[model samples]
Target: MFFVDTIELSGLGNRSYLAGGARTAVAVDPPRDIDQVLAAAARRGVRISHVVETHLHNDYVSGGLELARISGAVYLVPAAAHVSFERTAVHDGDTVEIDAGLTLRALATPGHTPHHTSYILEDSGMAVAVFTGGSLLIGTVGRPDLVEPRLTKQLARAQHASVHRLAAELADDTTVLPTHGFGSFCSSAQAAGTATTIGREKEVNDALVRDVDTFVADLLAGLEDIPAYYAHMGPVNAAGPAPVDLTPPALADAEDIAARLAAGEWVVDLRSRVAFAEGHLAGSYNFDADGQFATYLAWLVPWGKPVTLLAGSPEQLAAAQRELTRVGIDRPAAAAVGGPASWIREGEEPASFRRATFADLADRRASGDVVVLDVRRDSERADGHVEGSVHIPIHTLHRRLDEVPAGEVWVHCAGGMRAAIAASLLDAAGREVVAVDDGFRSAEEAGLTECGSHGDGGPTA
Candidate 1:
């Protein structure tokens, strides 16, 4: 019997699959850290015979090349992908045989990227599952705008055709497994369902239910802030990412931390937002581990800038390092474990900012002047937000500081984590800031927001 195991990279909001018979398997769209893939294969008692990528991902560094090399498997990449590495280039209609009467068939589905493909896993020639990577998501198709801006419209049209083709060819019972859509920015829009099938998709998937023009228009319009770090992912994947290094960086002391900060390097604290707001090194920024640490940290920090990680414990530091490595922030310049006290000299007091709720924001607004900064994405802000708050997505907040009107800044997001990150940046820049440590829903309940609107944008952080 063929078995399929999913490797969920929850931090990245992507999943890699390992599937085959009891003895042999194939891994699809693995992440940069292949150790988890290796462990899953070990648990399944299967030998990985093929490692394949559905596309050159624009989200995380691909571990397919290295995994194939390590497992002694044939690395299959789409033929149209412009890559410098040697591999068994696959095309539409190409099939890879597996043990025990199983097979994987490649079908061209270019929408998310120029060469995106979906792989159908078959048992005895009966279609059972299709690995629709970045093409057919749980309820929507992957975004078509990641490639070239000039090719976006063309890609949207292509994306529409691709999902339709899959729906037409695949059996209604075919299990539709996708790599994007589960909170990954690769999705054209947010997808909430835990599981979905091709048959179920026909009833709900916009690409399948709507006309090409309508689907394209809505998809394009809903596209929000593309993470700044995405610019590096495609190139890294095409060039074949180097093996990940999870070795802990050398320790940093107060002197080294001070010097790094003085030199303008990022000193990130991977603590809880509440703890960070209570106390943190003056120049150190909080891209707390309790949030989408990798996405936001990589999104805001300028590429190639050295970063020193500080965490409450060694475990937190190591965990943050693993997440960062997946996004190509391969090494921490230095790392420190312990609280703010350990990070500063005896006489030095850690920097801090006030933590307030939406109710507090309302109370403070009534008594004194404050600038309300909403650091949610444009897509989220559109769903309804604080009526007149300064809107700047957290990813763009670093460069758009000047746009924030002057005053004691009270920042908030769909949740408090992103707001804490924004508050840290604003705090470090000498602005009086208060992190709204509450849900956006409370903003309306507390009369701080009037989103005469449809729904909340879920928890973006």
Candidate 2:
């Protein structure tokens, strides 16, 4: 068996795969794009025989169907995915034999989502590895808050039970591969920068501590807010998303942008909001293309209108394009050839959006009673946050103006884009506002303490 592991690195997170015995591979929790999986298999001279979805993911759209279509691979999920996918739904004790000596068994591991499952692979009776999606993370268990808040306790119980099951069933030598890594919001405890053995995790991961109740309580503590688009992605993944049309027209110039703008295509700058505001082609809507780029574009940018991108570089253009396609936004009508800096140099000035870095935000947070506005979704705020930060998503800030403080308001998100927009909006609303440049990262790094709360509010919108 030529055991080959495929890893997908996207914006600080990763996905994993296992291939053995020539041209037969099992992909675990592939990202929304299946092309990369296919390419990886081809490079290793193997065929993808199966795509194993660790669970019905809420973070990014799943690419199981896409793999099935492109590679004729079998789609595998938990037996209770609750939807029709032409897959071999597996449950506890079910096993798929890829060869005479290799077997992958499905273990019913709930608590992330109701139907989450983990796969334990064995070769010649020796436990090779396990693919644990949300059920169990490297250092922490998957957050129970993905489901309804009222059921958090129920889910937490199930999660604890599932952890106990895995800890008993899998041996200490079993290698561990998780679906997400450090940057992912899916798991509260970040990955240990990389993959680790089950033994290593058992020795260190807090979720697997001696006491179940204590582990459960500690695991649920200080979970940051879930992204606003998390709810929107579940259905799309359940019902297989369509591929993005990458066949865009010829590279566009300034006139092309103007023409598209005249035709009602909003100029969405796929740059940082600060970069966009600092100097971008005038009339472009600031669409921060850093993280969750596709989700925001799909929700905010109106469909059926032509669009153009202002990428920071060629690499960024490709990333922006790929993310746009994950949500079914195939191709922009055109792209600015000169890039953002060129436009700035050419006198196509942008509105500079100033921001305060993590240190500055911390200073304001400590020195006085500056209004702190958290623009993340309600579920995210359920986790820890800057003590007493007002909760309001960027979308609803305008209507709920009365809720924000009249003092110097400092706005922030998990990162920075939404906070910049929130601050911009507050500034426009004639309230004193300063956007936190580093946002949550800065706050956490500065040793700012966060209060604990399981989310009680339902999904925001």
Clashes per candidate (backbone, < 3 Å): 0, 5
Residues 72-102, model 1: lDDT tens digits = 9999999999999999999999999977899
User: RMSD per prediction, one decimal?
Assistant: 1.1, 5.7
lDDT tens string, model 2, 24-79?
A: 77778876667787788877787778888877777676777777778887888788
Q: Which candidate gets the maximum TM-score versus the true structure?
A: 1
What are the clashing pairs of model 1? none
lDDT of each: 0.90, 0.70
RMSD of 1: 1.1
Superposition error at 343 for model 1 (Å) = 0.6
